[model samples]
Target: MREIELSLNQTQKIRLKRALEKLESLSSKANSNSNASVSISDSIPVNLEDGVLKGHGTLDLNGELVATVCGVVERVNKLVYVRALRARYKPEVGDIVVGRVSEVAQKRWRLDIHYSQDAVLMLSSMNLPDGIQRRRTALDELNMRSIFEENDVICAEVRGIQHDGLHLQARSQKYGKLERGQLLTVPPYLVRRRKQHFHHLEQYGVDLILGCNGFIWVGEHVEVKDDMVEDQVSKPEQQKSNKNSISLEEQEQTYTPIETRQNICRIANAVRVLSILGFNINIEVIMDTMNLSSSLNLDIHEMLGSEFCVLVAEGEAERRSLTKRKG
Candidate 1:
């Protein structure tokens, strides 16, 4: 049996169960139950006479379509594929992903992006800290630690997989090392890819990066500095000026305000609650959850209490029901 992780009393548990049941009922009614899942080697129902095409996560066994993994069956036109929820992330081109640097190898960083293998981010694929556009030299390779050290969290885009392995590139300003934040990991299925994954909550001064790989980052808003070097003569002096400045310890001592810390906790907890409830995690739903907590004036710690969990479940059930009705 699946265990519910939340600490709930009898009444809260009952309410949550009822709310979840209602949600499941509503979902089944809105869509065809053809999304039925099958286990590995199980025969999937299909009209073989109509020319069925086996896709990913499927195998042809004696001219029969068999599921290669345990997952929900999806049909796109004539193609049939199984979408496994508990499997490693399958990277697609242009997907924004958050990963931790596991190794600083020669001219590349090995990133753990929750895939079958570690993703590689080549040094030549990314921009320099000073944003200079030129051929990378041995000095740049020597200074690789300056850009990303082991265990540093980074956000980048999936550049197609090569013979080496899954490749990533951080060519844009937004794609680089993340700092002053918290990283939250949830099941990748909970997060749906949307047109916009990067959200800046101006109200709370928080930057939220919802990685398609299920690694969510909530951090302090960082302003992107203009790196255009207009004058060639003064560049060296400016570089020297930067080298003489603050140490890492001094920068680390710059404390974050209590209010910002509280806000971060609030948003992080909001994501946590949604993930626990198995709700679709999008920016709008996250904002709604955050607003609900703020409107109720609930303590930051109270947001994860049993009562709040039940309330959130009920709210999600109601929200989905209303959406179903509209459709």
Candidate 2:
């Protein structure tokens, strides 16, 4: 278990220890049924007559298959691989990821997605702000920085891995530059791949994007508006207003509400607590934790305190126990 450094009193320390032990017990019971944890150089039993195929994190030595990494062993048909509990993000096709722009090149932007190699977002792969499909010209290449400058945080889908490296695309309106959000990085393993990674908390007017690369974005919700409709509506208004004067709409876009900001912080802190506890992070779990904080009238910053961590640990243990019983 990873040690968490926090200030706590004697009573709080005792309570935290007990809660963590209970959580550990529950996790062990759950893992025992589904996975076999292995260490480095551990031999993986296999039937020679069946012809075993070793996959990633495995090495064949002296006609024996041994794990090359510390993780859980998984077998699929004749293929076997070890799933590392803590590792850098591994990109897969169609996975949603949030990454920061490392460099703005001629026709592509390089992004750091916590992977061994930086991912590439080509100009032809993404839709223009005007939502038009046309050939990218030299001018487009020249004005690339205007679209996405260096250090911009963007959300995109993994296109594929080619001879060069991993490529990403942002063809949809929902997948684009992210702004006014707190980006929180957690262990990629803690965030399992799911069907829906983008969530809008309507009640709080906040957007929660669980990036498969362990980049969690908590920001004020921005409605995906139709660019064509907006263009038609704004053309006449633009003619009426002075070109030098900023419009009310532009001002509104630049500002975020205080309540929304608070909610974003609250959600971000909940994710932090879950990451610190080494718990599986999902929308359901995050919402439950946020709701618990709200119910207890805990401040957003207080969620990081030792007392709240213990409470979360205990709650998680109970939740898992109930889930096991139901299963």
Give the per-residue lDDT of model 1 (tens digit) for 1-327: 124688888888899899989987886665455586678999988878898888888998887889999877889999899988676677899998999999999999999987889999999999787788899999989988877889989988999999999999987777888877899998888787787788878889788989999999988776665455211111111233355597988766656767888898999999998888878789888988989899999999999987887888899889988887897
Candidate 2 error regions (>4 Å): 60-64, 226-244, 247-254
Candidate 1 ranges with C-alpha deviation above 4 Å: 1-3, 33-45, 57-70, 226-244, 247-254
Q: Estimate each model's TM-score.
A: 0.87, 0.89
Please give the lDDT score for candidate 2.
0.84
RMSD vs true structure, all candidates = 5.0, 4.3
Q: Relative to the unseen true structure, what is the C-alpha lDDT of residue 114 in candidate 2, on a scale of 0 to 100? A: 84
Model 2 residue 290 CA deviation in Å: 0.7
The positional error of residue 94 in candidate 2, measured at the CA in angstroms, is 1.0
TM-score of model 1 vs. true structure: 0.87
- For residues 68-154, write the lDDT of model 2, one tens digit per residue: 999888989899999988878888999989999999986899999988999999999987866679999998898787678888788
Q: What is the lDDT of every predicted structure here?
A: 0.83, 0.84
